[model samples]
Target: LLEDVKTVNIGNEMAVTLSAGIGMDGLSYAQNFEFARNAIDLALGRGGDQAVVKTSASITYYGGKSQQMEKNTRVKARVKAHALEEIITGKDDVIVMGHRIGDVDSFGACVGIYRITKALEHPCHIVLNDVTTSTKPLVELFQDNDHYEKDLILSSQEALDKVSDNTVVVVVDVNKPSITECPELLHKAKTVVVFDHHRSGTEVIENATLSYVEPYASSTCEMVSEILQYIGEHVKIHPEEANAMYAGIMIDTNNFMQKTGVRTFEAAAFLRRNGADMTVIRKLFRENANEYKAKADAVSQAEIYRGAYAISVCSGEGLPSPTILGAQAANELLNIRGVKASFICTEYQNQIFVSARSIDEVNVQVIMEKLGGGGPLNIAGCQMEDVTGTEAIAIIKKTLDTMIEEGDL
Candidate 1:
């Protein structure tokens, strides 16, 4: 359980509840988790049972977690947002690129690129490597329809054959360049536009012409929805495209429950207004019996801790789609009562991928970041180098303990 309080921050070490209670300042649940971590270090060591909250009205607090005497020094750092915008008034040919295996969200973002390019009256091509099938129906729709033509959506070899430095690359849903489904296009393109909702890790395209990344948004679909809207009212979205984007939004937001925000609802409302059928979206996400069995087994293997749960670990068995199903499993486990934090660890292409989720009591992004992962406060994801599940689990536990001990749990 968690509580909230809105009060002035008075200077100095004052007693405050440290474990998990509303601080004198009204911090949101996510903020509370973050504050708990900060308070633990300050109040716990400074003769525990006192909190030192530093806010606008000056620092003050009351009762912190039981601990004792030490000096609480200030940590000052200036973090700035990188340059996010620039308009290239000229139009040119473009290519679409994404991660190793395209998922619904990334594919949906490609749809955004299509819309933007069409509005600009620029020629565009979407590169499809060996693994684009993971995105499913969208591929078939684009293939069967004559509207796609030979202009857009090419195979890996075809892309390499046609791509040139003049090509404007639009990377969707993913930021890491090292693991891109196609690296040739990224190397060949002179101008690039990246749109994604994932937390930034080490690998990102540094020279992108226009990059829009908002990890706080529910999905890349939501991000793309905004970009498409900005493009204007003329671009028509076919039924399949509309439904695919809707499906992407639905999948990323867990049917609009986990990471729903004002912008997310607005994006959904736009898709609904655009004639996207909810029934089609519902059908698109339906899985077979084997998938259901896997999800159920994954949940059964979950372990619970103090308001936190290591709900599922990725086993390579997800086969055709380890990340997608594994993400679903982790999101499902979050629905369990008392599970304040949810994690999904899966082995994807020999790399350990971890997705973390949190409610008010935990900051999943911070935890992921501490372990070379990154994301927003509520939902964040990361990939571990090449570690076994057992080693990864130990690292996770130690990180959780450190977070809890420092009051950030």
Candidate 2:
């Protein structure tokens, strides 16, 4: 086998071929190299934490080095202040919003903005969509407070009626285009701002006027913590707001073991000082019998890919089973001693959804980005509109093989 091998020539350089029958189809070496350079996506479609290299003829594997680079507190602090300063020069009339499927993090970020905007006296409307918020108890927190505004939940037409050039829209928790969580508010806006901790995959809604996209932060609540510091004099961290943000922080960090950071702890501590109750947070995350069973089944079927990585699939008729089930499975996979990365893919509403997580050493964000999705290095996701979970798995493996071939291992 060694004697049969030959050093493959591309342009000016030569790379040894792995005998997968890779060759150009009657094309010049230069043209093929350019073609390879252009069409080959160095990342994505793999389970992540790997790379892909495609020449004219074949693709092959390299595996398992997934953590993203660690962040420095000083650098993050400076960048945060710079972003805050850019918006300080001109405060405009705006509506605060979040994804339609509201979670504790989304609601927490919205409330953080509401408090600041209320102090700024901006005419803010938080336009919620449909009955997406029907399952949340946090709604009661806002509704009970007469000071917090709550009249804007409406139809897509109603939301569209409210947008204008001066109408600045701020989206929290997620930056993806499909607002299945809040589609109406996104549709009518010309200017938008996004503050999210999740990875940004391929699907998008143009660009926001101001976007603070950081996958390193633990949660949207952490990003909101930065914003609250910016508006230091105007607002206080109320108990309810603290509880909401704390719940998000704890959930994303998996109780501070998987992806927690110094800032994460600091934010949680501040919220605790404001009187956040852990018992109430426990109540919020409690799953019904159906949800618990769905999660357990997904975890049981999980398989280890490389020695360090694990992956599983959860197929369902709707979004909740996949979304909640995927995260729960990922958390469960982490329990295995050698496993550093966990990926769960499931079918939902005509789309294939994926959720990936890693220990502090792996960057799931970089891997997810290749699949047109993004988040912090430790946790991320992607959505495939016209594919099944099985097809998605093949794409991931081939991409991994190619990444190994290219030495992005």
Candidate 3:
């Protein structure tokens, strides 16, 4: 169909071109339409002017060579925010959850969800797991606050046991079904609403009753913050919760220096007016001496490549958890002159973790996905089993080389 469409020239100066998406083997017509819609999005996301086909088992792409145009998203966000409120009001209970081993962005978004549900007078619980050192300070702050009801934070097992037909699970920050705090809970819940700012991966929660994912936002908190505005003027965010969301936008945007945009600052301003404390947010970012030293050590091991990229492998016996250090190290490497993309690979918890950060010119998510992980274009990470940090770095380098050769970098 695309070839036939392209064969015609509407005018001497204008040639006709078409992009098509095909979907098949779906159990229902709705599922088939969704697959076709996603396939077309993939075709356009990879730079349009092509045809893409989606099946139950595979996705095939062809003839994409043009650049994609940037879209205006504010209107779309408002529409989804309104739709989300309707879904929440209809549900009996709302359970909020983020990715496992949550980060500030994840926790911040979760807090935002909790606040939204509270305003709606719905029963809400935040499904939490063991957090990394990076989230400890803020988590402790929330735990100490009287307003942050401790019992509302439950374990994955507890959340799963509470799930019922009328329960709505709100997954934030991360959208991949497998990485959510409780994939089982997500599967068990009758209604699911997802709010995420990360690039959608292949293994996403396709069955969400309401899905609000905007990859261009600075963080999931940024997306949530915007949604908060549409919930109701009477709805309010406590200082602690506002602070958490602010910290989320700060960390994800590298303190408004990385992917910060108009909406990012708008959300930050709204939080500030609602009593978000900048001083507290600054305190939340302060790392202990030991963790700071570890981050510095990771940065010290960095090696620059491809003139604009940096890679660091932190390997030693009994080092601190690599999850936080790797992320901090990746962020730190970006501060170095001439580095547009940075990758930090470290071994922790019997697995190799890779954190990748980059400017818009480089889509680190694509690179991370190549290593069996996914995230936004600017930030991404993956965990590798049975691989040393050195081995992971080698694999990253090989992937980078391939991307360069294919003009994908």
Candidate 4:
């Protein structure tokens, strides 16, 4: 039904799409209505153009093949920014956090939020547990520095202990609570806020005072940069802070080549005008010898499955951040001709991490969702436990075959 509805053309150059939600097994009509409301929100959050069915047991999705249209207006950003300012001003303090296994984008968004809270004259601390090799260089700039507080960054336990009733917990880069740097802080704080760019999933931070999640945005840093402008005219962005946010946009968009839009460039320009130095960010992201070799090996060993999917595995034995290498390898595999999508797997911390990427031919998010993961349509990932790399490949192949047979790919 959804596919048929999606086929309805309004004019010669355009077509209409529909999103729906169905609820079942509810005790009462009101309960079912609430369920349906949540389901519809999930459908739209996952980029619309789909149907979502929610029962007591599970949630199912259908017909989410189309890309989400970007909003040209900045009205939503302005409203969200005002709301965030109000929340921060009312709070006594703020605690900022991002997803686990911190990446450059995640930490950069944290820095942006930190700047916002400080400009509002509220105390703020960033909760970061593990800093990956890619983010260490950027993080070192603020660690133990005279310009920032000594307690600027804290561990999960310290953040949990410091969170108070009047403190506002701002989660950036990720919306899911399970993968956040500190989930316990959510329960400890009375107020919560979320700012992210990834498409939403079934799991999300509940009861957020402010939730600004834009799937069309290039990165969370881009979203935060826009919000920073609306916070106040006097809000200043230091060079290091601007560089951090700019690096995030650069990393997520693959250096402005992928997922680049007018707003994306505009956000980059905003950071640039505020003293973002591309040369410094480039130096911060320089690859070491081991990382370079590992990425090259993964690409050289890639297998083009069905002449459209490229699959490979990276042996990141000596690399400080194996998952980062795997993700980079997935991006590199897209250079191969006739490869519509790519998947690079790496064994890290007793789990198999699969990084999926594509240009436009495939919806990698759906593919990763099948394996209990979610991300944007072009870039996604999944983690598998107790599975060998070879077995993981076989499972992915079977999944591809099934999706192909069902006309889903």
Candidate 5:
């Protein structure tokens, strides 16, 4: 099939290319489907325009050296949303969780899920703990709201203690098992569901009852908002919840400057109709003087490479939180005229945390994946133990140089 696609030539001498994944020797249909999915991902990762066949014990590949076609559609998202509704409705307890250092996108999606579970008349709990600095303001707002129930928020250990045979864990904003706030609770849960906008990582949660990973969506909250549209009109979303989701979309889209699509706007409009106040969201984004100064120092310390890549390290004291500071620094560096991609390295929690961003040309996802991290093409991150900020920057530079030389960036 790939060869036939390659053989077809238009009058102007343009040829088409296709990639195929063939699954055979499977004991069941579901097993075969899983094999095909993994095979296709592998084929695309090796650079598409190829055919990959995966059996129970062996794998074979042919012809891969072309760019993979990008799929942008909402049909699959709708289907997955319905499937997730079914999974949530059938379960007794729904526990929602996000990655470590929960951000706006993560917490917003959790609130969305909590609303959904409540609408379905199922008991739900949001597993949360310490948040990054940027999320602190939003979390405080939620806590202060009359409609928000602090009792519904559980710590990792608390959630673990309540896990039952019928409990279903819904992981949002991230699907990677290694990055979740509590992988142990996830393991103990009877079922798992994932909704994320990030690219799939190597350490994915296995056998999720429903997995919705949309790399094209601006944020997980955007995907959750779209799901809400399909979940029936009677479903109620509070003003606070709506605002949280809206704030999430705004943060991930960089205030509508990055990765904004038609669907992204549609979600925002829905939130606006639900009383997502922009004034409150602006207040949530307001940074204190010290945080602003820390961000400025990070920008001043940035090192530009090849006139396109900007790398910065937060070396000094007084930075409020390394994770939030690194992300802020990365965003700040992108404002530079010639920089196409930016990376902010910081020391946090005894690890070197690197937050990376791009203007969609550098494919930061692939770059971060090499270092055991993953996200979308424009934003990605990784954390490394036993490495100083300077050493981590050097490793990143070396990796970038190799990818650039190989024409992979």
Candidate 6:
């Protein structure tokens, strides 16, 4: 039904798509209607052009092959910024968090929110645990500094202890509760806000006071940069903060080469006016000798599966952050001709992390979703437990075969 819907055209120049929701086996009519509404929201949240079926037992998806359309207006950002300002002003305190094992985009977005809360003269703390190598340099700028509070960054337990009835928790870069830096804070706070660029999935942070999840935005940093412009006319961005946010936009967009649009450049220009320096960001992200070698090895040893998918394993021995290298390797594999998508697997913290990337031909997000993970169509990831790299590769291959047979690939 969805495939046929996708084939419909408008005036032979543009295609018309449909998003559907089906609910079954409900105990009451109202419950069934609620389920249907939720399913349709999920389908639209996942970038439309899909169908979601919800039952009391499970949720299923179908036909999400289309690319998400980017909005060309800044009206939504302006409205969200004003709403966020009101929420912060009403709260006694604010706590900001990103996904665990923080990256530039995640940490940068946190900093952006911190600025907002501080400008309102509301006490704010960023919850971060286990800072990886990629994020340490940026984090150090805020630690033990007179410009910011001494407890600017707190651990999960510390955040939990500090959260109060009047606190508003702002989750950035990631929307999934399970992967948040401190999921407990969500339950403790009276109000919660979410800002992310990833497509919505089955799992999400429920009952958010405000949500700004634009899959079309290049990165969460881009979205935050736009919000910063409208927060207040006097909200000044420090060079360090500008640099942090700029690094996020740079890294997530792969130096403005992927997932970038006109608004992305506009956001970067805004940061530049606030004293963002490209040279400083480049110096911060410079790779060490071992890190470079590990990434190259992963790329050199890559295996092209089915002549379209590039698969490789990044060895983590003696590496501070192997998953970062894995994601870099995945991006590098896209340069190979005839490769529709790339998947780089790395063993870290007793689990296998798979970072998937694609240019256009394949929807890597759908594949990752089937493996219990999700992101944008171009960049996605999943994690598996108790599986060897070779075993994970075989499993991925089987999934690809099944998806291909079902005409989903």
Model 6, span 274-339: residue lDDT tens: 999998889989999999999999999999999999999999888988999999999999999999
Predicted structure 6, TM vs. truth: 0.98
Per-model C-alpha lDDT, please? 0.65, 0.64, 0.80, 0.91, 0.82, 0.92
Query: Which pairs in model 5 have colliding backbones?
Result: none
- Per-prediction tally of clashes: 20, 29, 0, 0, 0, 0
Tell me how candidate 3 scores on lDDT: 0.80
Q: Candidate 6 — worst ten consecutive residues by lDDT sum?
A: 6-15
- Which parts of model 1 are misplaced by more than 4 Å? 1-89, 130-134
Query: Whole-model lDDT for model 2 versus the true structure?
Result: 0.64
What stretches of model 2 exceed 4 Å from their correct place? Answer: 1-92, 100-102, 130-135, 144-147, 152-156, 176-191, 198-208, 232-234, 317-321
lDDT of 6: 0.92
Off by over 4 Å in 4: none
Measured with C-alpha atoms, the lDDT of residue 341 in candidate 5 is 92
- lDDT, candidate 3, 1-409, per-residue tens: 5456656865655445567888899999988899899888765544456787898898765553332333445787778878878888887888999988788999989888889889988888888878666677777877757786767788988988888998989999877899888899876888989888776566778778888776667789998888888886557888888988999999888888877777788899999999899887787778677767778888887889888889987653454455877887898898888998999987877888899997656778778877888776677899999888888888999999998898666
In terms of TM-score, how similar is model 1 to the real structure?
0.74
Candidate 2 residue lDDT tens string, 180-284? 355666667677777777644434455567777666677888777766765646467677777877877777778888656778888887778777899987786
Residue 313 lDDT (model 1):
75
Clashing pairs in 4: none
Winning candidate number (lDDT):
6
Model 2: lDDT of residue 50 = 35
- lDDT for 160 in candidate 6 is 93
lDDT of 1 at 42: 37
Local accuracy of candidate 4 as per-residue lDDT tens digits, 270-335? 999999998998888999887998899999999999999999999978677899889989998998
lDDT of 5 at 128: 85
Query: Residue 24 in candidate 1 has what lDDT?
Result: 40
